[model samples]
Target: MFKSLLSDRPGTEPLAAAFRACRTHFVWAAVFSALVNLLYLAPTLYMLQVYDRVVPTGGLTTLGLITAVAVFALACLAILDWLRGRLLLRAGLRLDRMLSSRILARVVDIQARSVGQAPGSQALREFDNVRTAVSGPGALALFDAPWTPLYLGCCFLLHPAIGLLTLVGGLILFTLAWRNERDSRPRLAKAIQSNAAAYAAQESVAGQAEVVRALGMRGSSIARQIDQRRGAVAQQADAQLTGGKYSGAIKFVRLVLQSAALGLAAYLVVKGEMSAGSIIAASVLLSRAVAPVELLVGAWPGLVQARSSWNTLVELFAKTAAQDRSRTALPPPAGRLRLEGVTVRLPDTETAQLRHAVLGLEPGQTLGVIGASGSGKTTLARVIAGALVPTAGDVRLDGAEYGARDGDELARFIGYMPQSPSLFAGSIKDNISRFSSATGLEAAEVDRTAVAAAIAAGAHEMILRLPHGYDTALGPYGAGVSAGQAQRIALARALYGDPCLLVLDEPNSNLDQEGETALMAAILGAATRGAAVVVVAHRAGVLARVDRLLVMRDGAVQLEGPREEVLARLREAPPAMVAAGRA
Candidate 1:
């Protein structure tokens, strides 16, 4: 079901899709906005009638009737204005619902493929900007902008001179808005880039706070962050300064034009070409006509940002769409693993991290991998666990290539414990259950499986000693737990649900002697349950129960075969060579 949801081609662009979802609400908003603008003319007309007819006749009855009509018009205007805002709010919410999930998924995909930090973490924020731009007062102003000519036409009806002056004022404000957009574009783009860099630098320092303090590099780290921040602030300030100048100029032009138009209207009135009513009405119409342009000037920066963000999201989604396309689902794997000519090269370098490495395993078998650091042991373990895809080779389970099945589906059958264990901020049960809601599992089932897995990994007793036992709330990175305790919990997580294959990379690195015994027992128990087990170890204790041994040197396999035979051969080698081999 999830595969189909992600794989289907969106019939339209993401932004378009979101807009389409809220099309009805937008339509209602546009209609109401138009009504509201139309009603705006009522007050101007009322002033015209009062000056031209009411005062001239001194008709109290006509005055009362005109006042009643004006009040009614204003009441309708208020209702329409409220309706527009309500519709816009609905549209914004609908747009969010339509786009947020897809964008978030794209972000996760980008982060997974990135070698360093991905800049797409701000995708949701960008999406919010787009939604805001669509629903903001600025957008409503743009909608009303097309009606500017109507207001100008009313001014012309009042007097030609008044109409001409208003037209020129509108043009000047538009010119200023255009200039603001042009000047702010590049600066805003630079500011965004620098801000992203600054954030990345700050996150790096936060992640390595312990290392920085240990090496006395805190001052240098702080200096680097400060430099990045300064760059961002400088670019942002420059953009703001440019935008501010244009905004000020536009405001000044608007005020001068309004005063000039009023003067022109008064002169026309005195010359008998227009009336006192026409002059007041013309001034009101002039303000109404220029309002949209003023709004456009104010919203120029946000509009540009939304455009850039939209383009970035489009490109990101296009890149990841093909990878997420639907594939044929395969039945569950049976722990028969194969790596045919597997090879992996390090990023940005020709050197191989794993060179044409090949291995196979059957159910109920345990393979122990041992070698010096950088010998591709961890890499091979990762490949088997489906954590890393080989550059050239096929990894298959139960005769089905890895690509034939979904990653999440395959993950259910594979238990992977990396060298450095990490946990989320959650209860012990949640961590052990691998955050089951992500897998669509029931709460009761998650609890049952979590307890069983904890027992299988020999972590049940240790967990029971905690203040809250399985309900203990862990801080980020599993704080409040010792290294040994965290490792045991991670092991329990890997063993959850009796997975068909178990891949352990230095699983016992932080374990005590008792922990090591529990680890050996877990390995044996898994093998007895007809599961394939792969252990990457640096110590001999983990090797005692393995059925087979594979030794690695550099990026290639150095030795393989039954554990007894490999151990006998290693014992016969010279002492210095054996010691170096162990190292």
Candidate 2:
């Protein structure tokens, strides 16, 4: 675990490798820290010489020379501090350059895999925390912390009494830091969890705002969010209050000890045991001795947070690195999809999600899948769309097994329209031109293809009626358009490239009667263009125009035949059986 914190570069081990690559910077920063701490002695030494030599002998020339030397030492100290800061800043930038993009890709991949079940955005925030804390006060404190003993040794050389007091003060500050960690850790952890849950809830509501507002539940939704986060807010407040108290106590200790060193020196001077300059000299050294400890104590929270973020990132990267990175790209598929004994199982259970399911589609074939909820229709659709890989079977396109890199190339040939309109923030033209090339083509060629796709989906007139037509801007998840409108736009996207494999999961769920007619026409039109299409719907009415029908139950296909044969069997079945299967 600790080894990861010491490595360099961002290649496979992004965090560790980056740190290792910046090792030179860390070494120079440490060297500068040492020089700065040593130069700090100049102030104490100058005070000792001035009061003992200049005041007692009244030597103006000697005082001037020593003062100049002290000023030079101070100047060098300031320069070293600045150089150290620059080193750390550069290291931070280097770390970011190596890790940020990798972290972002991992975040997106995690979200895509979980289908938004996991709040992966939190990982990006964690990356920010790590970067900030690494180059912020906590890291500086780390470099300075090891010099505390050297500072204390100097204090002892001045006077053992002064050293003892500084040591006691440092111990007190360290104790308070420990107490702060103990006091804040639980509440802060709870607060973090609550905050994540609240954010996930908000994303959920925002994604379904159309449904929530249409049902007049907007007020209740806000109330629900507030209630969910009340505990988290309370926990965060309590943690901050406790941390503030400890920090205040640490400052109080450092201040009191510095003054105490001065008083002790004054008493010794009064007894003729030391000269008057000893007072200031002892005080300065004592202050320097405990300052590093005070910094470490003050930066305790940031140190802990950075450590946590590092560990989290390490684990995430470790998992990702274990997977094969090399992927082979295959040729574009010819619309022949064959699934043989495909199986998908729950991660923690023996129960299968898709059990030994076999299906096939030739070019121009239209298959409608019908099943009740939990009957694996969505899972099958996801597998066919290459969104999810099968656990124990082969999913082949044109006799080629899908490789990791092949997915990207295959994407150009597979058009998947999920039940929820999967749209991004962009112009309608950009969204419809999913596979359109931006360069090396006539501007008219790209626009013409986008418009052609929209026209084929029966959305051309609707788009033209809008203020910007194909150039209209949209928000997340096809926002800036109504549900039916978004659905039509999505269909256009799926039909954009005239992809050989088209998979739509409940594509007509949000459509009106006229919209439904257009959708049916689009499906038939795609098949006429030699694209193999699979449509999943719970109701048979929407699938009336399909060439074949497949009914699923408990993750297995229960019935499959030509469309007419399947419908006739469903009609002749007993009413109870028909309702049970929802066929």
Candidate 3:
């Protein structure tokens, strides 16, 4: 069963290549282990020989000589074992880092659909499990596997029958353990999934701390949910324990097989087919086999987990990223975007969110996209920004086919701010620069210009009072900043790139009137600088500032013209008309 669990799809070329990079250390380690084993074997054989000689001749000097030789051999074995173990450990650690780096790179390259579909915990856990597998049990398994057979072969040469018997016994034990491992694979996979779900549920409760506290149902409402998840985790732990027991049972069965082999060897010696010296030597070899067998048994769980992790990692490595060809060089946008029969569809969902939507925006134009929540406004913006592919349509930037260009280059031409912006754990300067090394602006440049711009955008004078000013440390996940401050930081990051067009999803959110005024001024500034802007706004004051309004109702343009014209039309009809049109 244990053997079966380890029969994963062979590792890929990259993993093999990673292993090869540490070949020198592995070679030296193996050489040292072989020398130690040989020294260990010599002392055992000499002791057996001395015993037979002493029983017949009663030689004292010969016995003393044997004792000294044994002591020397043991000393040599100890030194070699220490050296080999250290070499192997160093090599294993190096390989672990190499493989981890490659895996993370692949993870970063993964497509949106695959990345989104994969649970975050699963992706992260796989790397850790595989690293332990490769660096710990994996290294030991590799060395012991070949070394066991070599040591056993020496015994076989001295007594062919004994060597053959031990071989057969070991094989049976391995087979039993492999089978147990195989049967546990699916159970382990399911257990991992269950654990992930439980963790996600726990995170949900923890993340919404304010809501749970404000509702004052913490002791009564969430307690039941928390208890349910805890029970599920306990059940998963029980399942893993059951699998562990199966492995233990296999080890016990192997021990019985080894005992049987030893008994048969004794029978051969008694029958006179084997010499007493050979019997003694065989016994020494058999005792040595115990270490190898136990090593394999102990490594079984790590190998099995590693196998599962490798399977997932291989899939990740083999993935072909979706083609994103929006990077071709194009003339800077003259503030014009044309969409022909644009449609937006989700990869994992059945329904198309936006159907055959048509729209156009000329240079210096400000389009306002307004609709009830979940009306596909955000999806449409994503398509226009080239972050997402339209099911059927072409988005032309300044009359150039958008898809023909490079996606990365297109990103450089447009400033896209999603509903929520992510900030790394760093100083204010790092948040604004986002570590972009795009030729003209470096981190220091962003520190001077971008930091002030972001503060100006959000009317954030309070930021100046921070202990380190722009260099103040932000906690991981931007915990040090407020929602409004983070948003402005995102705005600063967007502006740092000096994009030709701006797309803001909810720029007016979490801002006071003064902050809103700064945001409007920033948007107008971009337009005056020859860049067009498209905004998704709900605030009346915010909507009134835009040059034009493209109200999206049911994923289609409802009323698009000058801002005053659309606002007048909206006023003539009841507010419910906008909701009904969107529905």
Candidate 4:
């Protein structure tokens, strides 16, 4: 209900709800701040008493007592300020505890929906920014800024002239702060975008260092990445320069106005209007009044960035909400699958990559999808594997729709190996077992599963050849292993648990003759065990063992039949058509 009622707040429902959950901590922080601010007046009041009463009365004992009282008040003020900081820190921890998991899940959803378009790492960084703003000086400034008017009011009680001066100074500093925000925001935002792009480019190039090195393009790549960083740095410098000007002007105005208040108070003192105590007190009061505003001015950029991060999170959460996923369990699934008129369209356009692709597979059946470059074979495989939700049409597994099913549960039932092998940094067994250790499985059970999968993919012997065998560590993108070795291990990962539906997109692309034999064996092994298999390949020769064949051209299926018939037709077709089908 909060989600619907808080339409104006976008993603604030969960974040605000967490704050409400931690309201007690915030309340104590606010209370501590009030006490701290109240105690701030003690020193001024003590000076006034010393100047008006102690000095005139020649009572040294009374001066000693007042001094002690002022010292105690200051001590209490320091303690309360410390307590407030702890409270804000605790509140930040509570917010992180309540929302961190959900934020990460949203990141995964974004990446799975569109790879490399909106990076999930950005989501993590944004969450960290929001968390820091919640606990850092920015949040403390918000609590203290409320006391600005109280200080100004106290100054007014001292003298209307002094109050007026402080007010003008505040307005001037505040105007400068507003102008700083207005002028610097655009440049800062551009810098942030530029930095994100540069970091992304750098990571991409580093991950594919082998490709760049082999092509002898490392120098050009480094120069391109450096140029991206240079642009970000230039924009950041511009923003800092713009903000520095306002900061300097605000500081100058504050210092000058503080002295002017002292001058005015002194003149009044000489005229027997106000006491000497009032002069010193007025300066202290003016500084207190504007200090919160100054702190806020310094923290304006961070506050703005935190708010932007929150908005992005809101948009992301809305798109990926799964309210009933945990509450309602899906029916038990079998390998039986169907894609009725499935189509995947290009973004912001009507061009479909896979148009009305209708297909089906029963348990224990093997289907080979063959096509030339730019054909729809890969798109179809992605749809079948549940990686890409079709732009149109229903993908049915048993009686349940694929898109409507829970992602985690779906993973247990489907196995998909993409054209590229993505093996994370871990032991070879960790990658092949999908990090099953995190599932709290016993070591023996995990090892059993890992070894079974490796055997299925013909990678057990290859893994044993390594220094640590299954326990060997891999760098990012499986750096410790060769490309073919990584592919074989990824195949093992896909084959783990003997998933009911298995889809391999170009499984043999990185394989040698021996690896090709293993690839054929893995597909046949899974098929024999009642898993429906779909193998997408550019080279039709590797698919000779498939039970059926499918040919795609221009996002549409051109031929599909018994494997022998399809192969025979390709041979008799036009040379261009034959090349497209067999290439």
How do the residues 359-464 of candidate 1 rate in per-residue lDDT, one tens digit apiece?
Answer: 8899999999987888889889988988776778989999988767776678889999999878889999999998996768888899899999999999999999
> RMSDs, each prediction?
4.0, 3.7, 4.9, 2.6
Q: Measured by TM-score, how close is model 2 to the native structure?
A: 0.86
Looking at model 4, how many pairs of residues clash?
0
Error of 3 at 81 (Å): 5.2
User: For model 1, what is the alpha-carbon lDDT of residue 280?
Assistant: 77
lDDT of 3 by residue, 484-578 (tens): 77777777766656667778888778777666787888788777777778888666667667888777766666677887787678778677756
Lowest lDDT block of 10, candidate 4: 1-10
TM-score to true structure, per model: 0.90, 0.86, 0.80, 0.94
- Candidate 2 C-alpha lDDT tens digits along 1-583: 1354653433345666677888888899889999998998999999999999999999999999999999999999999999998998898898889878778766655443444443335777777777777677777777887888887887777778778887888788788888888988776677767877898798889888989999999999999999888877887788778888988898888788878988998998898877899899888887887787678766776667666666667656654552326665566677998889998874555688899999888999999998778888989998898887677898888887654444446677888889888888889988888635543656688799889999889999999998999999998877899989999999999888788999999998889988889889999999998999999987566798899888888898877879889878878988744654564
- Which rank order by lDDT, best down to worst? 4, 1, 2, 3
lDDT of 3: 0.68
* Residues 437-468, model 4: lDDT tens digits: 98797889889988999999998899999999
The regions of model 3 sitting more than 4 angstroms off are: 1-43, 53-111, 114-116, 119-121, 158-161, 217-239, 254-280, 287-294, 320-342, 359-363, 382-413, 435-443, 455-460, 559-577, 580-583
Q: Highest TM-score among the candidates is held by which one? A: 4
Between prediction 2 and prediction 3, which has the larger TM-score? 2
Give the deviation of candidate 2 from the true structure as CA RMSD.
3.7
Q: What is the lDDT of residue 86 in candidate 2?
A: 90
Which candidate would rank higher by lDDT, 2 or 4?
Answer: 4
